[model samples]
Target: MPVRLPGPAVTEELDRVLGDRAAPGYADLRRLPYLEMVLKESLRLYPPGPYGARETAEPLAVGEYRIPAGTVVFYPFRAIQLNPDHWPEPERFRPERFTPEQVAGRARLAWVPFGLGPRSCEGAGPAMVECRLLLAVLLKRFRFRPVPGHRVDATERFVRWAADDIRMVVTPRKAGPPPRS
Candidate 1:
């Protein structure tokens, strides 16, 4: 089956965050929690799509309105992600918020970056593995620092992204030798 690729813009930003860490396999990628946190932050803010809609099979009451049977129900993913009720300190960049324990305790329907239900994004697993591998390899070989004139300003484009693009400098690591000039 053909795979759905992550958006180019998203991929590029991920590259910036991953730097020299791209790896050859899942095992290598599994050790980067920080990478995972970055991706989670992206999803929470921009999600692949702005909102998700579904048809209700039966009538239900949501807040003050009675949602009739067969009505289309819209779930605003980004809005919910930013909702202070479900996420405290929502505007901050926090990787720990997605640690296994913290994520598990959150409301089941919250943080639907990949959507929810059976039809959610099928590529979630592969994408995550790819990201992890990249982070692992990069962290092991280089150090990243933001470029002098660059700063990340996040915006939305079917997904949350750096509004001004993420620009950084990658410096190779010297493990056990001193440079002789």
Candidate 2:
């Protein structure tokens, strides 16, 4: 997915924001708003855990129908994230959708990449930090370009995965030394 996007533009943004900082501390990571947006949009489109199930503790009314207790309800993350009512051009990968203004305007649960409520993944925070740091450092060192003719599709299972191996050519980046202090 990274390879499919405008790699140079993203890399430029990372360089502009991070410079020669090999390690992005928590504070630094917080400042990389576009990077956060990219990650959020990616997670929204392809959540690792596509569906979550919860057994109702008590009878509930949804819309016009009543759901009995003990009914196993499935929350389809992909479907909800892709719903056109909430996301225009849902299939397109546009990280700007996660801008502060846009996010503030949306429903709180409009995007639930890490699930929601008490059952949400405990590792969500750490995982996001790890991903952002790794991506930042890696993008600083290398450029990933998709191999032509390689087909990448999201497959549904217990978790979402690439239907086939994603092929990308990684090229080492060549840039001048970081600006001196």
Candidate 3:
């Protein structure tokens, strides 16, 4: 986050929400909406599972196309998330796209980083909470910047990840507001 426009703003939010707390706790996670937005935007760009497949239970119609029942349908999550129709400036890192008002305005399946429906990932809930909490604690304690000339690319595979891994420099942050009495 330190390399993106929202980085400093996120740090500010963390400082404000976790005031004198040293680190964030479970209850405090709900109070940090901006961090959640950032995580959503990140997931939209780099979904770990790039695609999903499901069998249609019933014949379906989309637009002028028709699909017979039992046909296997593939949902390309990365492509869908990057589609300009659902997400404006799809390649940009704009967390505002996930704001309550914005999310409510978009299609339900427009952002499915963890897949969806009955067979969707069972760990999605815990995963998101884990990410949010980890981000909060880390952002509060350190600043991260990509190492110079290190390009992180997500390869298409069973699960997507940077081939060489994303390299970054993490610097410890100075103490924030002193513990409140």
Better of 1 and 2 by lDDT: 2
Candidate 2 per-residue lDDT over residues 1-181, each given as its tens digit: 4334534555666666677766567778876778788888888888888888788999999999999999999999988899988899998888989998999988888898888899988999999999988877887788777898787887788878888878888999864444455
Ranking according to TM-score, highest score first: 3, 2, 1
Distance (Å) between predicted and true CA of 16, model 1? 21
The deviation in Å at residue 142 for candidate 1 is: 4.4
Please write out the lDDT profile of model 1 over residues 28-70, one tens digit for every residue.
3444455677677756755667777789889999899898899
TM-score of each: 0.67, 0.88, 0.89
- Which pairs clash in the backbone of model 3? none
lDDT by residue (tens digit), candidate 3, 42-118: 89988988799999999999899999999999989989999999999988899989999999999999999989898
Best by TM-score: 3
**Model 3 lowest lDDT segment of ten:** 1-10
* C-alpha lDDT values of all predictions: 0.64, 0.81, 0.85
2 versus 3: better TM-score goes to: 3
For candidate 3, give the lDDT: 0.85
Q: Which residue pairs show backbone clashes in model 1?
A: 20-138, 21-134, 21-137, 21-138, 22-134, 46-160, 153-163
Off by over 4 Å in 3: 1-6, 63-65, 178-181
Error of 2 at 80 (Å): 0.7
